[model samples]
Each structure stands twice: as C-alpha cells, then as structure tokens.
Target: MRIAIAGAGLAGLSTAWLLDPLHHTVLFEPQERLGGHSHTVTAEVDGHETPIDLGAQHISPTAFPALANLLDAVGLTQDLIPVPLSTTLQVHDAATGRPEVLLAGPHTADPGWPRTPVLGAAAGSLTALVTRAAEWETRDVSWERSLDELIEPLEVPRDHKDRLLYPLLASFVGCDIAEAREMSARAAMAFVLRVPPASPDTAPLWHNLKNGLGSLTTALAADLHHGEIHPGRGVDHVRRGRDGLDIIDTRGHHHHVDRLVLAIPPGEAARLLEPLAGTSAVCAALGTFDYVDVTVTAHTDPTYLPADRRHWSTNTITVHNGWSETTTWYGPINGAQAFKSWTTHRPQPPREPLADATFRQLRLTPAAIRARDVVGQAQGDGGVHFAGHYLQDIDSQESALLSAIATTQRIAPDSPRLTDMLTRAPHASDPPEKG
Candidate 1:
C-alpha cells in the first residue's frame, strides 16, 4: 500500500511517521523546511541576537500529551525547561506613573515587583479578587463581556486596562477581545486558567525546547527517514481513484496510492477536493471558520524588558480599551536573556501603511497578519482524508500532531510498525465532544 500526504507541517509529518513502513509513504512539502507553524526565527534585539518563535510558543506541560511523547521519543526530554509565570504588568497611567500587577490564578509570594505601589491589597482581598476572576472565567464569558465587567469598575491608578487586559486577551484569542467571538473568548480564558496554580514559592511550569522547536521537527523527520519527504512539491489537486486516491502535484505529476491524507489547511484542502466526486459537511463547515494574523518580533535586548528573572514596570499587558486593531505582549525566553513580543488577532488582508506601522511597533500587528489570508475550507470522504488543527476547536503544534497520529490509526488500523510508537493519553480526564 502506498500513502500520499500533502503539506509537511507537524500534522502531515506526524501522519507520515505513523503510516510509513506499514505503507510506502510519500510526503509533499512546499517549503524547504519542516517546522510549519512550529517556527523559531532569529532577530537582533538592541544589537544582540536572539531566537524567537514566529508561530507557536510556550506549551503548557499539562495540555500536550503528544508533544511530551514526541520529546521523550527523540531523547530531547532534557531540553525541556519550565518558564515561570510571575511578572509585573505596567500600563501608562495618567498622573500616576505607578503601574499595577493584574495577578490571577494562585497568589504567589513576593508578587515580584509592584508595577504600581502595592495598593495595600490584603491577602484575603487578593484571594477574593483572584477567585472572582476565576469565576468569570469558568462561566465562559466572552472576552468582551469579561473586560467590560472587570475593567469598568476597577479604580486602580495606572494604564492597567490597556496595558494589562488588552494584550492578554489578544494573545489568547489571536484577535482583540472586543472583536473576538464569544466561543473563542471562552476557550482561551478556560485554557489559561486551567494552568497549574503557581505560587511565588512554587514556580509555574511552561515548557519549550532549548535548542528551538526546529529540533523536534528535525528529529521526527530523521527518525521517519528523510527519503519519505518530497520537497518543493505543492499538491495541485486530489481525486478518488479505483483503488484509493490520485494525487496531482503542482508539476502535473500524478501518483496513485491506497490512501490520501490532505494535511494542508482546511481552505486549501477544500479547494483541492471540491473538484473531486464526494464531499462531506465537515468540509463545508470548515469554510465558515475564521482566522486572524499574528506578527512575531525577536529581540536580544534585556533593556525594554528584562530576562525571566527581573520584573519590569510593565512587561506583559493586554489592551482592549477604545478601538485597537490587535492585542500584544512581551516576554523572555528560556536559557537566554533575550526578550521578544508579538501582537496577534489583527485581520490579514492588505491595509494602509500607518495601520501596519502602529501594529508592527509591537513586532507584530494587523498589517503583517492581514497580508496572508488563512484557508478555511476542508472537505473529503472515504478514500480521502484531511488533517490539521484549523478545522478543529483548537489549533496548535500539539493538536496537529495528535490529529495526524489519530488519522493514521484510523486509516491503517493493523499496521504493526506503529505499535512501538507511543500512544498518547488524552490530556482532559473528561471526554472531548466528537465532531
């Protein structure tokens, strides 16, 4: 049996890794590299060089089972480092230069440095405030609703509303909370709050690879054998064949395979299979999914923002007041003192220069995001299959890998080769709703 897979993103590669050997697998990658959204690019920050992730960064240890397995399989578990979550969020406050820390989750000792003078907020009062924040979160409030309710009454001195709330919301939803869908808001808040409670004494754990995410991709590809990959080939079209699937590449080459895996974005897959014979509602529903653009900035300077150790007057903050195109934040990486920040959730369609510049000031902005439209249509059935996080409720490197592995299991159930590959346990104890 021969299997054909399109796109070499994490999901596509995962599928190939799982199905190969059992079947003669061929992978199509339009790009020269394999990381896809799991990207880390280098940029100069204040004359120093640093590596920053352009796509997915900071994976919570609790949320990614497949990622953990992949890391262990590649013997890169030692490269995983936990990034602490304590920091001071500063906002530009009028009259009062003092910034305040918008602390949530569990109360940590030494709330780092006070962004503004410690409002004399007592321990019990602080706990109650955090509990209230959690309550609003658990109820699945849209960021719009939560921000309106949480920001309006707080008479805290400083630009806390814009500096703290806005950026946090933007990073979560990849769009401004005001414009974000209620469902997206609920999901983001729920995910963030679910992080293991962190105390000043006990550091919160957020893990990432020390050598960069590329290390994981390179390792997986190597284990899978480099011969399976076909670089510089874009999937032009796909159709049902007598045995299974007929894949047409950009170069007009056709290959017959027992199974075809459309691991591209939903939109791209939908377009390719539209000309094919059968289609499913899943594909049509994919057309309705919307996406926002994210711009990434890499810097080596610990000046504007210090390393993970010291708290800045204003380090990571969210802005939602008035009308802003996107939400943004700044953070430090592990093993190095470099700092980087990005603004996400700005529309990606082409826009004017002023708008682009304002957004890019945060290293990422609406203009950079809007320039490229994300494909949302993914449709297929029977002989054909589709994979990627865009069609599902969550999109991330972890999700992509999970989808690929799961899809391959369904396509080739009796493959003995996949037995040695670790089977990942579901992260949530509760079963996920089936689509």
Candidate 2:
C-alpha cells in the first residue's frame, strides 16, 4: 500500500515509522520544520547552547512505555535524563495571595496538616472512582459525566475541593479549574490515575531527552527508509475516488495513494475530509471539538516564581483562579531559572512579564471529550485513519504516540512492527496504584 500521511508531528512520524519497510509511505507537513508540538528551542547561555522544550516536555517511561520503546528503537535511549524526584508544588491561594507548598518526592506528595486530611479523602475517592470505572467494560456512564459532576458527589468539603483536590486534578492535565471541571470524568480520571503515586524507592517519576524532544522526531525521520518527507507542503484538499484517494497540495500538485492517514488536528482533518465520500458525519464530529490557544513563555526571571526560594523547588505552580497562566520548572537550562509559563482558555498577557521567548499552541478544550467516540468511528473506517492528540481528550507526547500506535494497528494489523509496539506498550487498563 502507498500510504500518504498528513502532518509530520509525532503521530504522523510514528505512523510512517511503523508502516514503512512493509509499505511505501510519504509524509506531508505544512510547517517548514517537522516535530510540530514536540519542538525544542535553543538559547545561548554562559557560552553554551541550552535546549529548552517550548512544546511537549515530560515523558513517563513506566506509564507510557511506547515512547520509551520508540526512544530505544531510534537509539536515543542514552539521551533519556530522569527528572528530579524531589520537588514541590505551589498552589497559589487566591485569598492570601501567597503560595502554599506541597512537598513531592518520587511517587507521592507529603500531604501535611490541613491538606493531609482533605488530600487523603480526595485521593481515596478518586482511587475508588477510577477503580470502579476501570472495571466496567462499558464506560458510557463515566464518559457522560463531567469531572465536576463526578467530584460534586464526593463527600469532601467544598474548601478542600477548591484549594487542594480541584487544583491537583487541574494541574495533572495542565488545565485551569473551569476547564478541568468541564472535562469528562473518564478523561480526567484516566489522566489522574496514570500518574503513579510518589514512591521513595522509585528511581524517578519522569524523564526527558537530554538534548530535547525534537531529537526523538529527528531520529524517527532519519530512520525512515521507505518514506519521502515533504515539509512545507500543505495538503489543500482531500477527496476519495473510485481509484483510491486524491490529495491536492497547496502547490497545485496532485498525489494518489492507496490509503490516507490524517495525523493532523481534527479541525484540519475535518476541512479536508468534508468533501470526501461518506465522511460528512465524521467531519461534523471533528468540527465539534473546540480548541484553546496556549502561550508558553520561557524565561529565567525569578520574579515569575514565589518570593521564597524554598517554594521554587516545586516543579509546577498552579494558580487557583488564574486561567491565563500555569508555571512549570524547566530544571535550570543553561544556569538560568528556566521555566515555561502556560496561558490557557483566553487571550491575555502572561501573568507576569517574560524576559525570554514565547511559543504558542492550540490545545483541545474539554468539549473534545464528547467527540472521542466519533474519532474512533472515523479511524475504524477502512483506508483512512486519523491519528493525533485530538483523538484522545488530553494532548501530550504520550497521547500523540498512543494515537499513532492505535491508527497503525487499525490500518496495518499485519505489520510485525505494529504487533511488537502493542506488545511492549503499557496497558491503559492496568494503572499503577497511587500512594
């Protein structure tokens, strides 16, 4: 099969990687460079070029082994650097205007004092809900309920929910309180449960490529032997024909392929697939997914963090009512206070001024939760498979890779690579126990 993949992000690249050697493949990317959201930006600091990921940053080897396997396949396992296990989380208290610190180590947070009792209760409730939901063969009930709906029924106090529980859940997915609440119960629960509880004995909770995530994409692209990558060539339109599929690029060039894999965002896919045969329902479903613009500013300013250096130990600082910005610790890139501030939901300036460069991304809203089934239905349709972060409610490197694996499995079941990838991939059903 001559497979044509649109969008050269991790999903497109991974799909091409799995399908190549078995089938002739070609990848088209609209941007001049590949690695769409897995981008890494470099800065000259102290006479050294430092790599800071302005896009997808962290990876969990224990939870999402597909990414680890991919790194191994590309000979980049040596570049895997473990993130610091000893960290703190600063939850900004709206009323006091000061941040409350939650000490995190390895697999769990040291829930102290007022937060202890509430945190215990919330964790217990979430575990029960997630466990029960996981056991159910049909998640229709969980899927229909929003995170807010699921948490409202819990017996925790309103204050605790506002301060600790809600913020914790929101921080897990990198969304604000409102956005988290709007998320589907299943989507939120799946993300929350995937995070293994902090364990003192565990080596490290997360890892990142020493060079950057871009290296992974670069390696994947380099390893492709049977595919032609056309960066800066955008697909203008897509329509199915009796012969196969007709793809017209923005350059007025036409390409014919036996199969078409859309590894781009849903909105882009919808625009292209709308004119195709028997795809109106799918296009409509894709159109329903709304997106929020997020701006990530990379800076070295200590003012971006709390006044006390002790609070700076925290990897993530989530503001209770602030939807515009979420702070992330970049672990001292180039001897500077490296951090990325994420502004979500609405257009606004960074909560504080930034001294470094900023990168913007369009992320799916909680509304995408409702369209998950539709995306699956479209992917199941033969010949055309959709792979991207939008397929899953949360957008991350892990989800993007998983989406590609799923698309490859659906479109190329006979490929030995697909079987191997699936065999090595972690089972979503068997989540690790939280401490």
Q: Pick the candidate with the highest TM-score.
A: 2
Query: What stretches of model 1 exceed 4 Å from their correct place?
Result: 42-51, 92-167, 200-203, 301-310, 313-315, 318-332, 343-380, 391-393, 416-418, 421-435
Error of 1 at 213 (Å): 1.1
Q: Tens digits of per-residue lDDT for model 1 on 299-325?
A: 443322323333342224423232232
TM-score of 1: 0.71
1-435: candidate 2 lDDT, tens digit per residue: 888999999999999999878888989998898998888877654456778787777776776677777776667777776564333445566688666654332322333311121133534544555555565315456465666777676575675556555565565555666676776666656544565446533323566777889999899899888899999998899777676888888778889998999998888888988776788888888987755555667665454455555445325545545442456665432234466666453234454333433333433445566677877876756578899876764667878888888888777788777777767644333323223
Error of 1 at 214 (Å): 0.9
Task: Check candidate 2 and list the clashing pairs.
Answer: 88-314, 107-197, 107-198, 107-199, 108-198
Q: Per-prediction TM-score, please? A: 0.71, 0.80
Enumerate clash totals for all models, in the order shown: 22, 5
